[model samples]
Target chain A: MTNSIRAEWTKFRTVRGWVIGLLTAIPLTVLIGLLGPLGSSFDCAGPNGAQCRGNTPPIGPDGTPVFDTFYFVHRTLTGDGSVTARVGALRDAEPWAKAGLLLKEGTTSGSRYAAVLLTGGHGVRMQYDFTEDIAGPSPDEDRQWLRLTREGTTLTGETSSDGRRWSTVGTVRLDFGERVELGMFVSSPQHLETSNTFGGRLDRGAPTVATTSFDQVRTTGAAAEDWRGTAVGIDPAREHEVGFTDDGGDLTITGTGDIAPIPASAGSLGKTAENALVGAFAGLVAVLVVAALFATSEYRRGIIRTSFTANPRRGQLLAAKAVVVGGLSFVVGAVSSALALPLVERAELAEGFFQHPTTWLTELRLVLGTGLLFAVAAVLAVALGMFLRRGALTVTAVVVGVVLPYLLAVASVLPTGPAEVLVTVTPAAAFAIQQSVEEYPQVAASYTPADGYFPLSPTGGLVVLCGYAAVAVVLAAIATRRRDA
Target chain B: MSALHAEWTKAWTVPGTAWLLAGVVTLTPLLGVLAASSMAEGGDPARTSLLGVTLGQAAVVGLAVATVSGEYGTGMIRTTLTAVPRRLAVLRAKAFLVCMLTVAGGTAAVGASVAAGDALLPEGLSIAQGPVLRAAVGSVLYLALVGLLGVGVAALVRDAATAVGLVLGLLFLTPIVASLVSDPDWRERLLEWSPMTAGLAVQATVDLGSQPIGPWQGLGVLAAWASAALLAGAAALRLRDAS
Candidate 1:
């Protein structure tokens, strides 16, 4: 068994292509992980905005300075009422920019609210309490009808490609009352983007007011006949402040900052782990290829025949390969992630954002768990190769199984339920292990994919992935005994 | 014509061709049903209905690449060429046969997948819808073109493993790398040009304006990629020794 292990190890090291693939994993991980945060710390662009801003944690009583500010065309909705209008145009924008309609508890920027918004380029979103950006329709053209209806505490957001037909974007039970404010709004966050990797400079484009026009307004059920509006969260020294005008026919609003649910103050590092762990996917890809090729390449070259002749014990041979591939993948995943975390932390902190400090044990668990994820994925790939005996089939199947779930779950366009379902069922369930940000069912903050929560707990998710690997390995073992090489 | 028959026979005789094609048939609808079943009420019905095409294309690529590269692996390409001394003709024959098989499999797979989607989805989604019809038809062509891409890459590399990796990487990874890019316009451009992004864009029923490329245009981009790949494969086949 030892000799077989050593021989297999020799073969693994001998493959130059595999070695290069493994070596390249580190830099790809670094590039993806470290580079994502380059723009996370950027200050707002344009005149009078030369200040440390936008990076402030929205966990404030008044919310973050860059966000939680918007100009509104408002009216009081005492009961069940819907605010609907056709947005004529959205122009002159920022990346994290938005304009839409909202149902709010108070006119205060940090107030509990439900809104249907059209982002500058990111598409429509139904956001509540300043953070939970539910995927909305990517409507046809720039023209869209936005409506937010309130019945008691429940708010329903609907959009229309044309005014006659409506698609419900989403519904959320906001913590608002009967006499809540309903209005049209526009705001833009500080626009900073990472054009390149860490070596490349961040583009801090000047913040611009996203001027938007809302026409053909109609209201039903207890709406204010004499509607009033205001620039919520105005700052005396704020640059490019939100402004508005309500003509009899059309309402034009210009604003800066987001309108959603926000906590009272900067408390903990909610998204820091997600920020640090951008290397996970890149590392997983590199590891997946190398791990998959380990077993499949043997069959590809007919070297498995020679190896079987030497070992005869097929299970031992498979086991040895697993050990080798699993260990290599683990080291790759662990080292890359360990290196990535600090870079992400520095980038986050440098921008004056508070990353609620985590325990050392938590960090250690994340690093080890990330490594374990790659290792299990590697072993699974090996088993898949053995059973399938074709690199293309196995690799493709594994990718479809693992990566597809993650992609669907993260895609802002898809509904959140399928994303959660995918995470629950697929091998990507292991990603739950990397999910350090715990979603408290009680703490009704912004816990959406903008803040992600896996359906399963970390251990449970890993077990699901391990279950896949185990079943595949068992089938491969049984078949190895019965099939011809 | 005989060469085409010979290549077709060869593909049929291969160890897992039936299973591979069967896999395409079964998995397409299975994934489509699963996606549709899990879809939220507000999700794009057309895009959701044909979501299986994305997964099913991998099987098509695998089958197509294997049709060519397996011959190289087993040293049967020499016999294939000896039987048909015109190397380009043999390549073309293989290309023609693979594309036909893919299109046949693609049509069944896509048609059934959409049917499953229509069955599984809510009331608003229908195959009768214009965008859904285009998406369904375009997906078949997309699969056929992807198969050609596989055949071309396999011929160029002369190995199943490397060619599969290369094709999958080109089809899948570029979009991922492009998304990581910070420049919005550049990212959109990257998506517009990447074969997978452009090709798969055909399925989008809603939010046409936001797509990097139009549905027909996206399929055209994929078609261009397939053509370029097949031409390159033919050139490689003619220029190099049979090995």
Candidate 2:
């Protein structure tokens, strides 16, 4: 065994390709590792931006500021038993007005009004009374408050007791797609002859209030795209809604009509990038086949005898071949990873780049681990080649071993046990290493995400990857020993 | 005629050739079906079903490489050459035999993949669909082309281990590079020009417009690679003395 190892080492060291391949793997692994971190960023809003910016203040249909500026003012003025405030849209307005208007209590009236202002086809009125009530013989007091928002035909009303926690009070649907108005008016039924005004009431003026805050107000997100005359149906029964953005266009689904809304976060973007990598990397078979050919090419030239004569032990000859093949694969894998890093990193960065101290570790794991995986695949190829003692046979076995599990993973056999186990343990395990999301439950046993976990923990994936490589290596070793080269 | 008969007999008598072909027939679609089934449970059935093609092509490539490389490893190439003095004729004969066998095996494998994919996929994934049909048929052709590539590479390298390594590197290196590269334009170019990347483009059922190369064009790339390898191998065989 020692002699064989030495012989293998000698052969590997002498091959120029092996040296070049190793040099390539190191940088490639580093580069590919860098892609994930470069693409991600630290958002103040966790995951999907729930806290970032909830809603926009409304705007006029013509794109002008509806309410000048929100302010809180205090004043006192004499008034009758009732008062009225008039609110309406500006002239030459297109159809609807969108904005947030707040009315708060001032010192004069000693009354408080907490409300929002909005106007559209769908509208609602929300107001709450803040004054302490007298027991008896008191006139009923009615205060008008404005609170509303409009998005296309939909108008939403909100109420807040402590500004921090806001809740929707009610929703109203209206056919008014055009301009509308809103205001408050008060009236007193008593005539002048019926009673004289009291000293304090006659001297004082009407109460004044100020607006506290206004934000995210807009009037433009109301037009839905017209899908008339198009072959595609807007809301077909079979269609799956993927995403809807008032920013660009209407909601679009896949051609087959199944659409799932993609989460708006770096994690989702990372998964997308990873999926693309998996799809692209699936073509690695071509590379493995080429490597296998090189390993077995000597047999076709009647050089196996010469190779065996030089090495003496068949095991040594096979070991040398495995080392050479695996070494080349490692180089190729490393180079590929390096080149992919910048591309992947840029793609991730486009979403939002974040700096994480742990990112370096993740990169290291991905690059080196990926290189090792490819190396194991190469070793397996050599072992298969040796076992079959025929180039085609070895190639077939290796390809079957590599590719069959993937197919079986998708095949619909009655009992899914064997297939599942096969997929979980094979190249699928290798893929699990690439995951940035929680290891999928069915395919991964020991790797589970934490509570409220978002994506795959990078470290856990590395462990699973190591497991895959170890298995492949052990299998290759066993096959090499059991089979004739 | 006698030499052709002898070659045919020799190929048939080998247990490895039959076993390899059988594996191609049974394993390709079986794995495709499995992948499709697994994918259908959670994700897209068509995409999952076609997943096996990626792995199956590797096997096909291996099979092709072994066909030529095995002879080299066994030190029988010299004997075969002595029997048939015309090196080009021997190469041509080998190519013809391998192509015929690969086509037959590839057809079976592809047919099984489609059948299994259709059977194993979820109810919504219809194999009768145009894209699915294209993927299935293209997969067969893809395997055949991969086999030819193996044969050519094996001929050039003349060492089983080296030939396999070189072919796999050639096939897989481009996509890896394309993936790792940061520039979209460069990545797009690499993906478009890479033989395997271009060839596998035929498997895409979604977002054709976004593909680096058109499906037919991608297959053309693989064909070009195969032709080049064959030409190179033929030249090497003609120029070099047999061991």
Best by DockQ: 2
| Model 2 per-residue lDDT at B163 | 68
Off by over 4 Å in 2: A1-8, A14-359, A363-425, A431-485, B1-3, B35-51, B117-139, B172-192, B197-218
Q: Per-residue CA lDDT of candidate 2, range A1-485, in tens?
A: 65656655665567565455445544444443443343233343644545422211122222211122122211121111111122232222211222223222221122233234332222323322211111111111121123345444444455443334545654444333343222121111111111111000011222111111122222222222231111121223322321112223211111111001111122222233343243224334544554455455455555666776776656566666666667767767655664565565465545443211124455655556556667766676666555544555554455445544433332122123444466455543454444433322111111211111222243443344455445545565566556454
Q: What TM-score, over all chains together, does every model reach? A: 0.68, 0.52
The local distance difference test score of model 1 is: 0.73
lDDT of 1 by residue, B1-243 (tens): 999999889988887788889878888888778777876565467677677776787788789888888888778988998999999888888888878888888889988887787677775456787888888888888989999999898889876756766687677655544444334555577778889889988888876886889999999999899889988998999999887
Clashes of each: 13, 111
Instruction: Categorize the docking of model 2.
Output: incorrect
